[model samples]
Target: MSILKKHPERDPGTAEAVGGEELLVTGGHTFKTLTDKVSGIVEQKPPAQWWLIFVMAVSGMLLLVGVIGWLAWEGTGIWGLNNPVGWGWAIVNFVFWVGIGHAGTLISAILFLLRQQWRTAINRFAEAMTIFAVITALVFPGIHVGRIWLAYYMFPIPNQMLIWPNFRSPLLWDIFAVGTYFTVSTLFWYVGLIPDLATLRDRATNVRKKVLGFFALGWRGGNRQWQHYEKAYLMLAGLATPLVLSVHSVVATDFATSLVPGWHTTIFPPYFVAGAVFSGFGMVMTLALIARKIYGLEDIITVNHLEKMNKIILVTGSMVGYAYMTEFFIAWYSQNEFEVFAFVNRAFGPYAWAYWIMFLCNVITPQIFWFKKLRRSIPVMFVASIFVNIGMWFERFVITVTSLSRDYLPSSWDYFSPSIWDILTFVGSFGLFFTFFLLFLRFLPMVALSEVKGVLPEADPHFYHQKEGDTK
Candidate 1:
């Protein structure tokens, strides 16, 4: 029997199916159970695994800090930059991290706008992921400018000499684009947290209560407060929706506007946007699986939720694969030698290995999701998500390294290799990302309790009448 039919009071939305559709939340949870389950993660002492992972994540973050310091002190020469390949893993890492942040905003903003209630289960941490990924991404560009001290020049601050940033430069565009995206995403995340914070506040004692209360902004859960809260959330969601498209499109512009054969393509914006979403969803899937398992949130973060995410990964992966094929077709059709060479070299040249790895991961791995059995399987989806993340990172590497490594002249051509520092920097970035994520899991309500409650049958006015009628 459907959980809803078994427990007539449970409203699992209006979607109908043979067995009355799958429940988004299982285990016969009432609103109280839901709240207690999510809040308990914060209130209780973390498990040993949490402490182990936290220590490792902190180590990685410290390594990242140390590497950045070394880079600043010694200079960019420590990296493997050569004649033609001015860009290296730094830019690749930058783009990769930025793409990682995309899934969070897409989940929180776009899905919310579409009224995807399932999003409520995962949106909180996904939004947090966006914030941390952006923080990690912002680190690269600042240090990539070579002169760490002169990084201020990237900003549009008026000076005594009347010097200004080049408005036309795409690199300059990243500063404003990512900065605005971070600001809005942070606000949206914090706004969503207020009601949950109030819940924590009411339940806490001593310092915890005071801290939660301060962040809760004196929320009384009154009708007037809820009305204002809804309006603000709607406004923020509307604002962030366009950014879901625009931020990555602007990032793509960094490549599209360049005259480099592979980078200079009209198709880049949409292609990059699609790839970003694909990659972002992959990371979210990976984290969600881990979080769900560790916290024993099988009911809240159900297979139904994962299957939906896998479906998105499949769609976006197809789009990404289409973009890949279209790039080659355009290269061949245009009859441009440099462009053709760029695409050809990506497949057959020295870096062809990276290209194929990307192809396998981005194009082939997600194909498994076509089988409903595989998509819903926990292990299969977990591995596939990891592959997607790997493939997307290689996609950036292939684009950045291949095109730059082989330029217009053979004399300027050189193989771009990452030094030990490069590899460490990249690995350490995960430390930074996960450190923040672990802290978020420990201290905050990882699930949006208020939003989740809103989707319950109990939230529906007619639900009680229906239950009463059935009882009669």
Candidate 2:
């Protein structure tokens, strides 16, 4: 039932045969086999490792909840928000999680629009990661506002007090930007899931069937359904594509609009966008490697898919490095003493340790991918991806902390040190992120079964005719 036969003259070990395109899904898999492999993960009991990870993830999530409750009781006073460095780990984590989400929309929307068939294998989980990361990001802003009860004040809902949220606040902009990004991303992710969910629905019985059947929206895979699905998907993709650029730009605007020396810059939009994609791919690469290895999905996810992601990491990493340099150059060229000091202090001042760590991880680590061997090596990319995220987190730290730690006045300057609450709150956010991701992997098809099938050689009408002609 394999859709593709081995090319007689080609090496069997390679993904590509003589003069053919590289296989997206290897192992000579057919439609049925692919479906069975993906769907079986959800249908069967999760492995022991899954349970262990799930337990850890849930524990982390509980820690987050406990921390939030304590934070609400004690108020923001418990955080390490000093006079100069008012924003601490909370804002750093907010931006980090938001940046972590950009790759999903880029993969799911931008690449799909460009007709990159390779996206089929990874886009589903990438889209899911986007939603989850956004969820995590939203939490920081909510809790950081201090009064969790009055968090609703951020919204423009007509209230008895007639107190309106200042529309000019970047925080308000983030509410709309990230909220829309999350909504469309969830819709895009769900639309992509419909066919695969229906596949699961038909394969399940009793309670599972009813549950999946409800979400599947009666997807029968009929031609009419296919047409409507494709149209809806395309529209959503179009809608989401702009959000990829706009969301991060809005985030950058949070910094750019400020008169703070390090923050005030025109380059932040593109710079932030590049960093977001860089960090986003790093996360996707990390998760994809773990998922494929754990589930024996190598043939489906494929090294080619991973290598492509590495290449992106490299490209965006380079862009991020360039942005770093550009920030310094602008600082120097503008002849502004505050800007110069901000950039200089980031490299050599009190928090220079963090700055160099950011530089090493964000700028230098990904340069390894310039080599083909390293790019394709699983271990290298995995470690590099981890470093990429670490560096990216520090990048935000450097930008946020270094800027505020030393401002216009020398006397008011103070070093920002995060309290234990700051550390626990940030760590707990990861727990929340992983909990959602693990649950998603447990319940949903991580790969888009239908989309992957569409890219297979057999999906072409001429494939059958060509095979027959070759035999003749």
Candidate 3:
């Protein structure tokens, strides 16, 4: 088998599955058929749908480019941002997309560490989401600075004043956090592509495909090469796991470090992480649903996969809900009137609608997962995912707005609304996200062709047993 010949460590670090005598390999070395499966992809392409994705992606790109052009020409005066409501959708969108990026990492890294094989099927596309979402996210903060050219200041550079980025500042932390995440995630995705590229290398018939595929780094199924590759992958995976925690922790510090009552809280770090995974899963669900339908990847994507993700949503949803309750309790128990009023006004005051909507969507809607049937149903899952996305968006909205609205000075209090640009740009962000993702779907393997094959029963099911029954 070429897989074992090319890759080393069949079932990399796989232990014997329960009641089974075989050791399963996960790193593609064990799955010789991986390349064959991946190469078979284009054969399954629906010409009509592929064209549709192309058209939508092009349209989205136009919206993103057009919006940026308009914003650049008109200046920051075009936004709804004001004195107390200084941070508007731009920041909210930044945090929102960044938070959405977390699901990919969790699925790829955390789930892998826990040996959840189901993750393999969706990890590729989800990682793509992480990349594009981060890209869209990066745009907001860079532009939020008003002078787009000065965005370089976020990074420390050699200058006449010898100005260096401040490590103590949360904003500076964001630059490093986001940069590291993007770089590491990209490396992880590409490195995992080697053998698959080789598969393409072997299967490609045209001069262009052969040349491009070969340059994907001449990879023959060499055991030694696989050993080194597996080591690097594991090492990177280990490194990436902590980066996931730290990056979002740093993002939360942006608000928590501030003196504002609603913003100032130690729970922010974990809260943000939970919300990030929550929203990210919602996004993955959104994409996976469409991808499965259009690409006809049902057998690989599976209903069980959706259910597993739903269970995670339920868990994270509860964690986020607990965060809300804990935050309120702490605010009241702290005996601080500013914090007390901030929490009170958010609930029973002018923004009560947002608060209730957030509660109902986040806290109430996820309860549908209690029924196993609903969790696995595609339509139900889609609806629940939409609810989570709305809830998570409102989660950011509530945090940013409630904190900034009624500050210590009552006279400075004001309710903010999004401008036309703000609303369109927000909508256009989805276009940007989908645009990048749709391209990945068409040009690249939407599924981790090699990785998934490695986890298939033929490769060494003994290695990737996510449950005891899989031991067989």
Question: How high is the CA lDDT of each candidate model?
Answer: 0.91, 0.91, 0.82
Candidate 1 lDDT over 1-472, as tens digits, reads 2234455534534422222445567777778888899999999999888999999999999999999899999999999888788989889999999999999999998998898989999999999999999999998998888789888888999876798889888888888899999999999999999999999999999999999999999999999989989999999999999987889999999988999999999999999999999999999999999999999999888899999999999999999999999999999999999999999999999999999999999999999999999989999999999999999999999999999988799888899888999999999999999999999999999999999888765665555545545432
Instruction: Count clashing pairs, candidate 2.
Output: 0
TM-score of each: 0.95, 0.95, 0.89
Residue 313 CA displacement from its true place in model 1, Å: 0.3
What 10-residue stretch in candidate 1 is worst by lDDT?
Answer: 12-21
Candidate 1 TM-score, C-alpha based: 0.95
- Model 1 residue 362 lDDT? 99
Which residue window of length 10 is worst by lDDT in model 3? 21-30
List ranges where model 2 is wrong by over 4 Å: 1-19, 470-472
Better of 1 and 3 by lDDT: 1
Predicted candidate 2 versus true structure: per-residue lDDT over 105-139, tens digit per residue: 99999999999989999999999999999999999
For candidate 2, list the clashing residue pairs, or say none.
Answer: none
True lDDT of residue 136, candidate 1: 92
